[model samples]
Target chain A: AQSVTQLDSQVPVFEEAPVELRCNYSSSVSVYLFWYVQYPNQGLQLLLKYLSGSTLVKGINGFEAEFNKSQTSFHLRKPSVHISDTAEYFCAVTDRSNTGKLIFGQGTTLQVKP
Target chain B: DTAVSQTPKYLVTQMGNDKSIKCEQNLGHDTMYWYKQDSKKFLKIMFSYNNKELIINETVPNRFSPKSPDKAHLNLHINSLELGDSAVYFCASSQGAGGSLDTQYFGPGTRLTVL
Candidate 1:
């Protein structure tokens, strides 16, 4: 079984400020990491995924995450954020066992203020 | 247009009542899944179907039943709903035999509120 932990439950930032949402996972075998975003009363949308290769993976809406294997972390970062970026973010993981079952974190709500 | 869709966006019912939520995917994918999102925003997979066959059934209560009529439709029926069952249910679909490379597209969730 795999599990994900999001350190912060809420993050507040001013518009055009940088932000980072930390995520860590525990898995016995190799795994794939992903970040998803959800707006109010809407379904989740994929922000980015880390299957293999480069540690730094870029995603939509100018968001990026770096996969740190040694630290067991995949933290999502954005250099600049907008008011529209206020949403809930989830970090998920899945092993390559072909089940494609994603274990998600408790989510971090990013509040981008003006 | 709505790659994946779910019916009855909001369901408000009394305890012990039976209800069903319908899901359909037109992405031509062979696999469909049902996930529950709690009030705290923790998403968990409940059941999955591949080509109308049951594949992944989690440790959910027997009261929650998933029915797959075909490759594109998966319906979840809950019997005697409890207060703990009040949450958002999301339907998703992916391609290629449940591989990680396939991205799962999600439908606007159905919020179930049991009173």
Candidate 2:
């Protein structure tokens, strides 16, 4: 079974500031990594996913995540954030099995303040 | 147009009551999934279906039953709902099944509040 852990439960940053949401995973076999964003009272939206390619994956809304195999980490980063970027972020992983079941982390709340 | 959609955006019912949430996707995808999101923002996959066939069934309670009448519809029926069942349920669909790398599109979600 695979599992995901988000290091921070909450991250508060000012508008236009840079932010990073750390995520780590544990899996016996190769896996796919993904980052999803959810606004208040909204369903999750896919930010990005790393299947098999460059370690550094770029996503929508100017977000990016680097897949670090050695560290077992896939941290999402943004050079500059807007107030609208405040939302809950989730890190998820799924093994290369036929099921393709996703295991998600607890989630990190990013509060981008003015 | 909505790619994926769920009915009864909010559901409030008493304990021991039965309720159902409906989901549909027009993306022409063959796979659909149901996920539960707790109050603390924790998510877990409950069930998945491909081409109207059951594929993934997690360790969820038997009270939570998922039904797929067609390739585009997946419905969740909960019997004797408990307080722990009060959470948001999301429906998602992907293009393929059995290790397909297609992205899953999510519906707006149905918030179930058991009193």
Candidate 3:
């Protein structure tokens, strides 16, 4: 079994400000981690993923995340965010043997203000 | 081209009525899933299918059912719809990669309202 926990429910930041969305997980077996973004009235889009070999992973829209195995965390970060970057973000994980089913977190909403 | 698509973007129906939401993926992926997002914004997995095989069936009520005629289509049918069934349903698909590690593309969600 695998479960994900995104620490913050909402985050408010100004344009060009650095932002970080914290995520942690607990799983009994080898798992894959993913970050997804959903704009208002839109479906989710993949932001980043942690599969193997690399702790640091870069994604679209200048966003990036680091997969920390020892800490069991995959935190997303961006140095400078744009107004269009405001959206809901989700963290998900699933055990490989579980037939590709994902266990998602509660999700974090990023409110980028001008 | 749209990778994933769902029909009937909005649906409003009375209790006891039956409704279905259609979903399709053009990415040639072999895995498909149905997820529900509640009013409070919590997303939960309802079902998962791969190559027309039922894979993961969550603790969801039996009223909610998913049917996949082929790898490119996964449709959901709800019977005896109740007020509690009102929520945004999202359909997603991904490549049949081991460990469920592939990137999934999602459809614009169907906002179902059970009145």
Candidate 4:
């Protein structure tokens, strides 16, 4: 079984400020990592993912994540954030198996303040 | 066109009632999934089906049954729903189970409120 841990439950930042949402995973077999975002009263949308061939993966809305295998971390970062970026962020991991099932973290709420 | 669509965007019913949620994906994907978002906003995979075959069935209660008549549609039927069953249910689909990576596109989700 695979599990993900998001260290931050909530993150507050002003507009245009840099931010980082930490995520870690524990799995015996190989795994794929992903980050998803959900606005108020909406379904989840994929932010970025780390499959292979690249340590840094860029996603929509200027968001990116770095896959650190040694540290078992896939932290999401944004150089600058806008007010519209305020939403709930989730970190998820799926085993190398083709089950298409994912285990998600508790989620982190990013509140971009004015 | 919508990649994935779920009916009854919001469902509110008393406890012990029976209800169903319909979902369809026009993406022609072979795999579809159902995920639940609880009050804490934690998303958990409840079921996964491929080509009308059950693949992943989590520890969800038997009252929450999922039926797939075809590859493009997956419907969830809840018998005697409980208060704990109140949550946002999302339907998602991907090209295949083991593509380069499983990138699933999700529907807007149907919120269920049990009173």
Candidate with top TM-score is: 1
List of clashing residue pairs for candidate 1: none
Q: Model 2, B50-112: lDDT tens per residue?
A: 999999999999999999999999999999999999999999999888353667788999999
Residue-pair clashes per candidate:
0, 0, 0, 0
In candidate 3 chain B, where is summed lDDT lowest over 10 consecutive residues? B96-105
Candidate 4, residues B40-101, lDDT tens digits: the string is 98999999998999999999999999999999999999999899999999999888753438
Candidate 2 local Cα displacement, residue A49, angstroms? 0.8
Report per-prediction Cα RMSD to one decimal: 0.7, 0.9, 1.3, 1.1
For residue B90, what is the lDDT in candidate 3?
99
Residues A1-114, candidate 3: write the lDDT tens digits: 778999999999999999999999999788889999999999999998888887999998899999998899999999999999999999999777647777889999999999
Interface RMSD of 3: 1.9
What lDDT tens digits, residue by residue, belong to model 1 across residues A1-114? Answer: 899999999999999999999999999999999999999989999999999999999999999999999999999999999999999999999998777798999999999999
lDDT of 3 by residue, B1-115 (tens): 8889999999999999999999999999988999999998888888888899888899999999999999999999999999999999999998874137677789999999988
Give the DockQ-based CAPRI class for model 3. medium
Could you report the DockQ of all the candidates, in the order they appear?
Answer: 0.82, 0.71, 0.70, 0.66
- Model 4, which residues run further than 4 Å from truth? B98-100
True contacts kept of 4: 0.62
Give lDDT tens digits, candidate 4, residues A45-108: 9999988888999999999999999999999999999999999999999877778888999999
Clash pairs, candidate 2, are: none
Worst 10 residues of 3 chain A by lDDT: A94-103
